[model samples]
Target: MTTLDKRQRVANPTYEPQPYSVTGYPTFRSFYPYYLGEHAHPVCLVGTTISLSVFVRALLAVLPLLSPAKQFAALRFGTQGWKSVGKLLLGGLLQGYVWAWIGHFFFERNKPATFKHPFYSLLGDLTLWKEVATLKRRP
Candidate 1:
């Protein structure tokens, strides 16, 4: 039997970064192609999703605790609850924000994908989370 050539044995790559000319556009629609390019690395997407999930959970938890009706009336008007909620929101925001920041700052600083492509960023986040779940279930 004839042997296959070594060059032909190599598997084709699945992902390639888009060229700068295609990715450099300023509009959200235009930037989405580049944003999709950045998400080829699953870890970045997963980290962002996890961070956002944690932030939302924290916010929901704090809402009841911070509500004026949930606490004593006299202390409610001027007290720590509002401050607590503000801190919680800030902390949650930082968690999600930092993940995207790290990806932009460290990995793909040239394109800065999330700045103009919030929708695709969110799509990447959810898609990565689903991938993680599927992988975890594999035998």
Candidate 2:
């Protein structure tokens, strides 16, 4: 709403993202082909790769604090650590969506399924990320 509100929101992010699923597809196997179709544009693929890289690195950075040896609540990351988590998660999400949107609107000329099918779209992104990472497919 206001500058103060934005700062407060960023300082105390209320959202915690978790993987979810919808009835959009009976199984991920059934959905992969459709996901591939939506991401046919080269720009979309590139954007996805970059976003996933950032997100994975961020997740890795934050993961040690969550390990069983540390006992999640007992391990304190303080302000900087928290900020790192926020930056990685938010930055990757924002970056990916922006590029994907641009590709969809300008190049691909299609509406992103992310709006209607967030869970499936996420699965699609991760799946593609794996393919690209393993050099199975080009992103």
Q: TM-score of each candidate?
A: 0.51, 0.61
lDDT for each candidate structure: 0.53, 0.66
- Cα lDDT of model 2 by residue, 1-139, tens digit: 5544543432112222222345566766666666666666557676777787787777666765566565454334335776867877888899888988898899877778789778878887777766556555554
Model 2 pairs in collision: none
- Please tell me which predicted candidate would have the highest TM-score against the true structure: 2
Off by over 4 Å in 1: 1-13, 19-34, 46-50, 63-79, 136-139
Give the Å shift of residue 25 in candidate 1.
Answer: 10
- Candidate 1 structure quality by residue, lDDT tens digits, 1-139: 1223432332222334665554356554554445455555544664566666666755565655656575534333224665755666676667777776776667655545456556656665555455445542111
Off by over 4 Å in 2: 1-24, 59-79
Question: How many Å off is the CA of 13 in candidate 1?
Answer: 9.7
* TM-score, candidate number 1: 0.51
